[model samples]
Target: MRRVLSGLVLLLAVLAGTTAAAAEPATETVHYTFDGPSPLTDVSGHGHDLTPVSRFGGAFTTVAHNGGQALVFPSPCHAEPCPRIALRAATTTGLNPGRRPLRYGASVRLAADQTTKGENVLQKGFSAQGSQYKLQIDGLAGRPSCVLVDDRRPQIHAAISNVGVADDRWHTLECRRAGSRLSILVDGVTRGRATVPADLSVSNRRPFSLGGKGSYPDNDQFQGILDEVWVRIG
Candidate 1:
């Protein structure tokens, strides 16, 4: 009976160890698949829905891509008020990663000809204000980069990728913030990385913007298709 008791205790200890070593799943802060009529709807049950604020009525629309629906922003936008969407700062909840490990990304498809001066895929807060997180395709290169400014610091931590994603192919681009490290991933592979402050935290009262900032001449508009945009905070 003593041997049997010892064996049971050992089994319990091993099971406990295994449970402790297992990884915990990240929480879905907000997600938009852009697969249905309600493309701007946040299906993650977080109620972080977006509102379209484009000057051109047809700037924001849906197109079929990759065996599913994808949100489309006018190529070149040509003029001001190019396609854009936003979530109000007051309504944005569980979207800020304050000193937390965060992962946010999107599936993008852009032709080379669609490149713009700057394209904002996702942004919250403004760098000028001192605390922000932005995922944007920079310059005419169409290379995605992740920017972080935390703790009201004026300095910007940018992780820029060399790979241009405007080849008319569906590529998954992700920005990961793990402690002091920030990384840019293309197609599930790390393409760029930068070291940030270990205690850096992003918390601000700024509306989340996508595709572009506004109807300005230089909204940094995105000219492409985006799908499965998500933000996960852990």
Candidate 2:
């Protein structure tokens, strides 16, 4: 009887441990396949709508990519002024991950001649306010690289990847913020990382913008095809 009681106690302890682990919050993921209806919608059931900024003067279309459909941003240049394709959500309440650890992933393919200066791939927040962060490619020194910028503080924190992204090729890009460390990954490989404040929070009242900041000009627009865009937070 004593031995059976001891075994039961150990089994109960193990079950309790497993239960606690299961109680932890699961990773929340928002994926945008861009294969939905016109105007693009988040298929992850998050109900985030992608709206185009008409003032930028660029149209969003679906093009071919990886044997499927992907959102394409044609050059926004006409003659004198070439605005970049801009699309963003009206609110960041359920879209943003707040101050918790989060990861942003996307499969992107740049156009053959899409090397525009200061072109942004993904960003959240405005330039006027100090609470903004961005994940960009090839916006630094005209090189094909991944850049993560955090502007929540007085000094801007940027983490740039060492590997250069090839043009006209599909590549998986990811930026992860775990604790105080921000890491940039290319094709599932960690390329760059920067140490930020542990309490650094990316929370902002502004809406989350994609392709580029809504208030900014076309110089920072993104000229490429983006697919499988997702944001995971825990």
Candidate 3:
């Protein structure tokens, strides 16, 4: 009987050890909390520290929720050049996971502050002519539109015309990448879809950012709330 009991104890101990070893540690999540009726100061988890891109008085701010954060950028950059709030990745370590055929995701609510510029919106990824991919949302005249640039050539093969989420409410946005096909969904609906040949070489090396490009000094910038930006690999 003693031998039998000893054997059972050994088996249990081995099982426990195996369970502990197989468990995966939780990934760290960073949050930049905010409250309504207030201005922004700092944004976190961008992998890099942030600096105000415009001379505006406030920084990007957020509100805390469910261990996550809400982000907001105010607009009306009326100067000769539209004002912009930019977020640069801290370091490649945790920011760029190097997952090719990368799966980019986020939830955002945006408006184009194009009082002067022709268009207003938010843009992400690199915009170089022939190397990188760009994902953009153009919210102009209180209308929401999405565009996908598969190659740096500024060749836009797919676009969603009337996204229409101009209200001040929060909207969910998601993008999926597999091989040469890039699919996009807004507010949980399929808005725009495109397939790019692998030869184009759209990749996951360049860092992620918010705010419009500065190609033209008078381009538009985004205004409103941006929340729950994340990336997932499946």
Candidate 4:
């Protein structure tokens, strides 16, 4: 009788442990569907407010994309000292996903006449010197490509897509970092992947900029339309 009782207790304990593990909170996900009356706000209930980096020139305007509103960056007066939109300080604090896995995705459409070489679409960090990660539609070899960079010197580990993305058509670009591997996907297709430090983390007090990095000019500004930006942290 005692042996049967012990077996029952062990079964209950195992079941309890499984239940507890399953009850753990899922990943935190934030999505921005640019449907708004004026200035855009994150509809993901994450409280991330998009603000203009500059008061004047670089402000984003609302345009239609896929039957929804999208943020558009008009032609800038100059490539350097251009205006940009971003979420700074307090707004970016919750983006710290610790050392766990994270993913960033955006729906972008390049202008038909896009002549710029390096147009930054999304980035998290203060400047090139302080960059933790960045995703840009750049013309590295005189051809448009989607590039993803982490905190690496010379960026040799940066992931570059095999196909060009600046076709003036809407495309979904995504970067996912899991364990020590980083993968870049364009339109649900894997573009490239690279191995990064297992302990790589972007948990810092830096502004998460869209359209471009606030400090850099010339190559970091994005001139196009952006919609449905999403971020997930596990």
Candidate with better lDDT, 2 vs 3: 2
Mind giving the per-residue lDDT tens digits that candidate 2 earns over 1-234?
999999999999999999999976666666777774553677777777678874546676788766668888766363655655577776765545556787887888875467666667777665456455667777423233333334456556666788766467788888888778888888898888888677766656676666766634544777777788788877
1-234: candidate 4 lDDT, tens digit per residue? 999999999999999999998976467666778886744677778777676665345566788777879888857445345564443324465776656787888888875466366777766653345336667777633133333334433243466777776677888998888878888898999978878767655655676667776633443667778888888887
lDDT for model 4: 0.67
Leading candidate by lDDT = 1
- Name the lDDT value of residue 5 in candidate 2: 100
Clashing pairs in 3: 33-62, 34-62, 34-63, 47-90, 48-90, 129-152, 129-153
Candidate 3: residue 114 lDDT (0-100): 31
Task: Tell how far residue 222 is off in model 3, in angstroms.
Answer: 1.7
lDDT of 3 by residue, 1-234 (tens): 999999999999999998987773334333323334432322343333333455434356665644655666655655544445555444243433222454444555654343222233333444445334334454354444434455435665444434655555567766666656667777777776667655444434444455444324543455566655555433
Residue runs of model 3 more than 4 Å from their true location after superposition: 1-52, 56-58, 63-69, 79-82, 91-99, 111-125, 139-154, 203-206, 214-220
Cα lDDT computed for each candidate against the true fold: 0.80, 0.69, 0.49, 0.67
Error of 4 at 160 (Å): 1.1
Alpha-carbon deviation at 215 in model 4, angstroms: 7.0
Q: Estimate each model's TM-score.
A: 0.83, 0.81, 0.60, 0.78
Candidate 1: stretches off by over 4 Å: 1-28, 56-58, 78-90
Model 1 misses residue 175 by how many Å? 0.6
Summed backbone clashes in each candidate are: 0, 0, 7, 1
RMSD to truth, every model: 3.5, 3.3, 6.7, 3.9
